[model samples]
Target: MSKQRSDEPEIEPFTGPAGGWGSVRSLAEVLPRERVAPDALRQLARQNKPDGFMCVSCAWPKPADHHPAEFCEEGAKATAWELTTLRTTPEFFREHTLTELRGWKDYDLEQHGRLTHPLRYDAESDRYVACSWEEAFDAIGASLRPLDPKSVVFYSSGRASLEASYLYALMARMYGNQNLPDSSNMCHESTSVGLKAAIGVPVGTTQLRDFEECDCILFFGQNVGSNAPRMLHDLRSARKRGVEILTFNPLKERGLERFTDPQNPIEMATGGETQISTQYHQVKAGGDIAAMMGIAKFLIEWDDAALSVGDPPVLDHAFIAQHTKDFESFADAVREANWADIERESGLARTALEETARVYARSEAVLGIYGMGLTQHVKGVENVRMLVNLLLMRGNIGKPGAGPTPVRGHSNVQGQRTVGITEKTELAPVEKLKELYGFDPPTEKGLDTIEACRGVIDGSVRAFVGLGGNFLRAAPDTDAMEAAWPRLDLSVQIATKLNRNHLFPGKVTYLLPCLGRIEEDVQASGPQAVSVEDSTSCIHGSRGKAKPASPHLLSEPRIVAEIAKRIAPANPRVDWDGWIADYAGIRDAIEATYPEMFRDFNARLFTPGGFWKGNKAAERIWQTPSGRAEFLAPGELNATGFADADGRFRLMTLRSNDQFNTTIYGYHDRFRGVKGTRDVLFINQADMAKAGVEEGQIVALESDAGDGTTRRREGLIVTPYDIPRGCLGAYYPEANVLLPVEHHAEQSHVPAAKSVPVRIRP
Candidate 1:
């Protein structure tokens, strides 16, 4: 390690295990500072409970038998962040001009806290002024009424409830608008697209109990420590039970290495930690497809050898012959694969691949778990399919303790998609929607996140309605998107807190404050409970017990319903007012729309751990065109073509331990040993040495997309760490500037955030 300067961020290895006193310390530090210490504590007590709200964090599933404290460190931050006492009232906005606020950091902007009233931008003064809800809604209606429906974008974030999302989707369709771009478009859209193409279902097949039963679990590119800390409990228990856990990522994430369960009193008392991963492989960034192919090749060759000797088959030939299609083509591709290329591209030796394959062959049951690391790539869709290919080789799908599980990021991202907040017209229940709402939903494909960005840039999109989320910050090419944001004729954001997205005022802009998920929402009908679908496809009810941040703040359903009533064409059959009055009515409509999946939705919602929306693939029922699981393979070994032959590094943007998505809770990343800054880069020690770059050396990175446009981020301090050679890591939203909006996954169109071809600016 090189010597650090005084101005450099505090950098050191975190020796402590994940989720011990570190989590406690973080919560302790954040709560009081946010001035929500008492109230947030009360809310945290009920988080993830049967009668309480779902955590406003990652979409990790809740166990049937819930722990007394089910929320994690990040979840606690989310709760405290929302339950903050700091208020961004009309007077607060009056003090800060839009131009001035636009120059502030994302963290500083949000520190002003929960939005108290509806606000409209005053271009004359270059500031936001307080406006009545009626004025805001009318302005939105006036702006939206004249625009072509196709010119409008209804962007929903994962934080919005299913009820709110349903209303938003319905409103968009009623107005003949098809664009329903959302947070999912940036993260797990590849998982949905790939899984649907391969298995007919778009969601993960494994239930929470599968963790207990699986003999082995393979994790890909997911950092469970920071992103989904609650998952540590399951992994710790699985480790204690002697299950083999294997991890593949550019960084050897501390969470996957070992975990000290905060919930385990004995472990907490003894300061004991459970060793998590049996083998942690630091694979090259964007090399998941290559690595997956190598594993499959080894397995196939082993099976071939066994078959030649007339030995018991290593592969599940019965499962393949009966339940799958196009196996021979996939096998042929694997057979034709060269071991040397696979080894070189994946940055793993052949021995390691063979050993991983041996583990898979011997295990009776295995769970294939992954996150955006596999999905946010040039070949993201192929990456997901390749993982599924490995699982299908051992008859993993449609079996207990087995299947591909995409660990989703947000609390209700999957639920938002389930409720029809999608750009894909086919995903919506059009016939059912028409019957319910008396309108023909738009059949044309809508703009996804990438297309939405393009639409805004080219001035095709006239309006942008955000249900929630920091759209510009979460998007690729952050600076470009932010610059292009003002091009929209109208911009409306329904959110809980003040963020930088709201500062980028459009020609006609409005900021509508909505109730946070952890705050009490008392509609006209009475107290209401919203539902969210977890990563496991379990639909559960979430009811807030804490006091509202402000009396003026409206519930998400009400805000969406009010906006719909104003802007959307009148539908006598649809009762938006009644649905807002009672969220149960919304649930009833959801059941009517997706009858097969949500039958008895309201009745089953409050059940201890909610009801499972069963996966068709898990039943060995493939809904593909051939009525069988399709074995798809990428055309080549260098799937992304982000080779290091030209000395360009594959950059994967990451979230700090203190951050959740674009929400910067603090400047500390406890796991990776970053502190007081988000602008540092993590490069391999050897790579840094070879490049003559010292630790804490300020450097610049520029995109090498060969598009003649320079996407660069400067003044980043290079920090040598345990990342793979030819790979570099930087925090997202900060590094998002380095990714071009056009560089995204094929077929899915999700931003290729995990693998961007870039070079260090000397």
Candidate 2:
């Protein structure tokens, strides 16, 4: 057989509403080829149901009322991909060497199929061999027992269910390790830190129901159509209800511009679509903070002018006075922000900012929704805080239809954090763990994702255990990470499919196959259901009905329990077997851990649509040091101008419509009008002219990290796109090699993947 080759990417302009017959056709093509069973439609129907499996693509909240089909095209692709009949057994691994596998693209590696059995690396043979669960567990235990607990870093993916995350956290703490680095560190850590500082909470305050009541909604740096397709339904409905939707993004996302719900048969058949965004502002890359501050300044000026005439004040004076603090300082900062600086930084006119402010001020209830665009920046925390400052000016929080909402990427990422997966070991969860499991949790701050990578590079982290993620490919500075990964004494990955991470073996590597979310998980007691928290903080049960991909597969909860049993056999406090046998017991423990928040956890699962976890910000109850919502002011507006002296473009890494996180479903990005390949860069037409480059010119991209360390990706076809001048867009993982590991958000420590300074080489 010959080596696989990607076809040349074909680029064209797409002009249609997102999610219509096109999505339906795409789903049809993938489903049949994946050998989806006849009952696959039934299984899809049950998705997002109270007692059914949750879509593994995104964390958008499920509606209170269930539709016949609650899943999106991306969700369908994820499900079909998971349920594919292909299997990667021992023979498959024997046929392909690690070196050969390394040559394949990320999509091909996972597309090869589901892992069937446990495998261990045979360094002498340079291949993986079949290993029993007992042997793998024993080897892991022996390797971990000798190493200092601090030398091991336990990392988790957001895809892990609440039960698995809870058990993984417990197992790590019981083993006396606090280095818990999760996927959230790379994505939403900025939102957590920013929101915690401003409103005393890390989660979004807006509920799904709030969309119904919102008069105006602002989408900052988020592409709702591609990232979270289901969100378009809410936007379409809101638009129909005369709700004004304002969009601020560098690219003109079709989902935010116009959307045709695939679920609406009449609209799909008639080729009718609803316009989503009333006003679309093309902000520059890393300019969200400036745009937000500009809006705040306009609102403050309007309020002052209104108050000077003794007329009705534009600002919510009563709400601000009663429910907030530090208003004077925050207002001063907004007032002092210069318009010229804001315009230069945001790449938007002053009149546009004033118009947005006018719409916001006139609306009784407004909602601000953002994604990684706002969070994956050098000053990501400040960007989020500035957004909150804008909303606070009108008292948006703790009210119906108004608040700040950070849309999470992964399906259960928010749930994983809610279930105690954090580097910081808080007193309440630590005390609860001691009471329930009799283990003293670590008190010291642990390593985050970046710190974990640094630890691996410095040889401080010897053993690595991953619970469901492709850490090697997902992390930044691919060259550095690849170099650091082999230094570990042992590395283990608990995953459902074969990813690039598995090919990068340590001294002793183990690949443990776990059941996918679409498969039945039969525990010692019986079939079990795991719960996940949505972006809106709704806790619901997800029970898979599909058959297991392989009989050798073990549930994630069971794997964690067995691993803990081997590593901490002498710890008599916790009954690992008991917890794995039944997941309800785990929920009971979660209730004990967060008594006030998760009271009656098991019973609440039976509710028609899941129970809300309840946010204090939603209730107008502040939990900050001042016992009120605090207005955190941002610093001076210092935007990384569109281009540098050397004509370097500000490159923002993005995901294609056919991809989720590190998982690539196909080579086509229907919405973006790219097909057949991923090796392409979306550049503005003017930038092409300025750089003396033509359309479809293959160019090399070199990072301007300023560390004298050269990092570059060669032979990338330049496609002129509808983007801001001097700004370029490229797919992640493929472009991750250009990002420096040390370049990250100031306070959140998240790698600034969204805003990397790079220069093109012809």
Candidate 3:
């Protein structure tokens, strides 16, 4: 390991429960720093409320009877970030060269604040010059119109609303190809792929209210308090009702252990924490498949024992027989699974797995909740399938408080996919588009984030249009991506704030500032409400109540419509002007396309808490090829796409308590006892001594992919943490450099950020 560093971050054990006075103090500290502090507070009060805007942070569902202060700590920060009075106008760009801006950190770049005008890169000045929206649109249209549809990529972030996403996808399809890739490709794409094969639906089965009814909630690889603090309210309520909470992760997350409601006065005043997890197991990184199989194995063996004794069956045989298929193969796979391998891979004692199984067996209703930690693996899809298989053993699907829940990141990522922002043309509204507009949609497959990046590197994709996200930062293999990004012919970013991705301007680049979700979106008709679908497939309206950060800022829907009208062939049938004039027209179009799920879209959208699209899996109506729930088996315990090499450890990237996705709010990771710095690695004490690394030692990490390319991240301070012995943790974006671009899941192609084989070195 490298020599010890003198400038070390303040590290201490966090003994307090999550979301107590600590959370309040965090919000209090940040709220005052925002230039629009008073406005942000006003907006926070309206967040997630009826007729108000949705939180721009995580996609945790809001309850029907929303809290007076519906926003959480992170949500409040996101609001403040959006509502900041700071501006990055043409003057700001002129003052700082692209090269100078490129050297700045991601957080510092965004802190310069929201973009106030449209800008075009000027090669002579090495700066972005202010331009009229029409001029920018015309330039973009000219560049895009002549290109082959397959050569262009449209990237959408989860921050986009359903209206904007709908138009964005429609524009791409109308323009002829579906080179549509978004944030979902990185986070929960595995859940979509896995659940569709197993349970027929691509979303979580439980509604927001199901947490109250569930007998047991099993959490796998999710840090609810940090990612989506609002979910803690439900978890705390479930705990109070005597529901069992079991957690399996590489690190014993503070959120999954205990949480005190910041909203509840009694708990906040008393500092009383409601215990979250009944059992917390520190499973190995990328060992979710093995851990899941171990639980399933125990249940299967117990069922066999019951059957042999002529006693009551442990498995839900009646439900399984009537509602599932391929159970025998899955059961046989679990039966043949080696206990030694399970014990080794999962890093859990057999007794612990058995005890978890016992609790699962007795529970009348069980809910499996997970996040990117389970999905960002080489076998990410299989990892999800294994969890689904465990749930299927007890017929958890199609029942109240019983199903697999993939907690989603971003506000509207699922909604983006729902609105046809995907490379999969089959998921697009092919027939509807044909009927509505006189054009043939491209039948050929388009590119996802991974394929798109490769296309850029190889010179196939010449153009990139991003709708609200720090794409380059969120992507794996950061260095390669940065080097290859400038190769694109045309690049456009429609966003609220300036990010690192904007610094790497293309040959012909345009930065189009757009209104934030928290800002008012006024059209020709009046103030418009856009809809977004939550993790549970519940679609709701979010009408911005806060003032626009800039007068020049255009709504996303309007920008997308303008681009569509300019780039796409003129079609009298496609009423782009009308859609921008009244967002209800867009909703009507969506309803017409997806009639079943979005019937009376406009009417139901304004209803309190909006409407649930409803999952067929919850009703025991499987749409799978087998016409029933599936029991697919994951054959291998090693899902990192590589074997255990000598002196190599499994590393997973983490988000700090003060961060959300790639948007860094501050350096402190209070949950992990990290302060004033993010460049720290969390390793177990045993692993530290084993590797000859001590606390405060600045080390470097090199990928063990052996792909001839060196992927390394240096200047990391080692800190002993409560992680598994062979597992290590570090913050993302910084660690993203260590991941190879090609290293992704077998089926989903989602980046394997949760498990990367690496060596700590000097």
Best by TM-score: 3
TM per prediction: 0.98, 0.98, 0.99
Highest lDDT scorer: 3
Task: Please give, for residues 534-652, the per-residue lDDT of candidate 3 as tens digits.
Answer: 88888989988788888998999999999998888888988999999999999999988898999999989966766988778999999899999988878798777777766999999
True-structure lDDT of candidate 1: 0.88
lDDT of 1 by residue, 1-762 (tens): 244454747888889989898988998899887898476777788899888899998999987798988899999999989988999888986788988887798899888788888899999988888889999988899999989999999998898888888888888888887799998899999999999999999988999999988999999989999999999998988888999998898898889888888888898899999999998888888878888898899889889999999999998999999999888899999999998899888999988888888898899899999999899988889999998998888899988899999999989999999989998888988888888777888898988999999888888988999989999888888777888889889999988888878889889999999898888889888898999989999998999988898888898889888888887877788898889888999999998999988999988988887799888999999989999999996776655645565668898899889989989999889998888888798899898878778888878899998888888998788888888888899889889889998899988989998889998875
lDDT ranking, best first: 3, 1, 2
| Best-first order by TM-score | 3, 1, 2
> Candidate 3, overall lDDT?
0.89
Which residue runs of candidate 1 sit more than 4 Å off their true CA positions? Answer: 1-8
RMSD of each: 1.5, 2.5, 1.1
For candidate 2, the clash count comes to: 0
- Shift of residue 321 alpha carbon in model 3, Å: 0.9
Q: Lowest summed-lDDT stretch of 10 residues in model 2?
A: 1-10
